[model samples]
Target: MRIGILGSGNVAKSLSRGFVARGDEVRLGTRTGSKAQLAAWIAEQHLAIAQGTLEGVTGWAEAIVLAMRGMANPETVRAAGEPAFRGKVVIDATNPLVWRADGFPSLGLPEPESAGARLQKDLPGAKVVKAFNTIGHAHMVRPQFANPPTMFICGDDPTAKTWVTELLRDFGWSSIVDVGGIERSRLLESLCVLWITCGMRLENWNIAMRLEQRI
Candidate 1:
């Protein structure tokens, strides 16, 4: 699989490593069109990944991952060009976060409006799925816990969601829950706030959410 990740940040690097580990060709697309820092980091990590501009990577990838900051979604998509995303599955791993003076985070968007939902609107030609936002990047791939944590995802496209579910499995997630369409991202993004609050209070960044079923 050819995967294009938009952003050179921690989340993009983490997901690139996971994709490469799974034998997928990965590329890091930067919004700034400058690759000096990203190239150095790639060499330092000894990863088999390529770096390019947003538009170039989007055209080259079979699937795309939006790993940029939540507020930068519109700009990133505009730089990448929406036409390039048609017929592709785009994994939205962003959260509309606003930090308080005390350092706590809150959702920037109001009810019924979420990063995932906005991305879907921005790229109507692409299948957008909300995922990888409720947990830390450190535990994104193959999280180790007493019981496997659940990856909750939502999207309007059934095929896209199925593809993302399989990708999650490849990344070592055993339990995945589909919470519904992209609109449900409101709940999922809120879940991130809870996750962060717990981590801050417990002073632990390794925790993940799990769902236990009676069945």
Candidate 2:
């Protein structure tokens, strides 16, 4: 699979590496100034190509990963052109988080529902699924947990959800839990707060969430 990731930040780069490791091609998209960094990463990792513009990548990839800043998703859509994402499974790994006056992060989704819902609204032609938002970038793929962590995924399109599940499996996840439709994205997004707060308070960022059950 050819994956195009919008944003050269940590999340995007981390996912790109994971995809490439799983033998899927990757094209990292970024602004002109970020291309050098992207190029360095590509060379260092010896992965696939990198594009300087959003349109460049959107056209090249079979699937898209919207790993950009949550508030900037609309801009990414406009830059990539709405028509390019039609019928493609877009993995949304964003959270609409903003620091509040109390020095804690909070959801700032303009759509007031969830980031997945908001992205679906922004790219009506695209199939958007919420995932990879509950964990840190370093632990995105093949996490070093005591046990396999649970990945909570949700999307309106069942087919899209299945597709993302396959991809996540390839990335070394074996415990993926489908929590429900896109509306449930709110819960996943909010989970980030707990993950972050616990990490900060405990002074540990290497921990992860695992769903345990009795046989």
Candidate 3:
């Protein structure tokens, strides 16, 4: 699989590493196309990931991952161009988090609207799935826990969700829950606030949510 991830941040790097580990060709899209900026990190990690401009990567990839900051979605879309995303499954791994002075974060968007929904609206031609937002980047792939955590995802397109679920399994997830359409992203984004609050209170940054079913 050819994966194009937008952003050069932690989330992008983590996902890129995971995809590469699974024998997928990964390319990271950055604001700048200069490979020199990410060359050192790539060599240090010893991963064969490529770097390119946003538009270039989007055109080259079979699938795209929006790993940019929540607020930067519009700009990212503009930078990558809308037409390039048509018929591609875009994994939205963003949270519309508004950080405050006390170090706590809140949702930037109001009810019934979320980053995932907005992305879907922005890229109507693409299949957008909300995922990888409720967990930390370090534990995104092959997380080790007493019990495997459930990856809750939502999207209007069932096929896209299915694709993401299979990818999650490849990344070592045994349990996955599809929480309905993109509108359900409101709930998942709120879940991120809860995750952050718990991490701050417990002073532990390595926590994940698990749904224990009675089945």
Error of 1 at 42 (Å): 0.8
Candidate 2 overall lDDT versus native = 0.86
Tell me the spans in candidate 2 whose CA falls farther than 4 Å from its real position: 110-112
Estimate the lDDT of model 1. Answer: 0.94
Report the number of backbone clashes for model 1. 0
Q: Which stretches of candidate 3 lie over 4 Å from their true place?
A: 35-37
> Over the full model, what C-alpha lDDT does candidate 3 score relative to the true structure?
0.94
Clashes of each: 0, 0, 0
Candidate 3 lDDT, tens digit per residue, 147-214? 99888999999999999999999999998999999999999999999999999999998899999989
Summarize candidate 1's per-residue lDDT along 21-95 as a digit string, tens digits. 999999999976667888898999999898889999999999999999997899999999999999999999999
Instruction: Give the lowest summed-lDDT range of ten residues in model 3.
Output: 32-41
Question: Could you tell me which 10 consecutive residues in candidate 2 have the lowest summed lDDT?
Answer: 30-39
TM-score of 2: 0.94
Give model 2 RMSD, 1 decimal: 1.7
Q: Residue by residue across 1-215, what tens digits does model 2's lDDT show? A: 88889988999989988887888888878755257767887788776665657898888889999999987788888888989999999999998888888777778864448888878888888888999999999999988787999999998899999999998898889999999888788898888878887887888989889898889
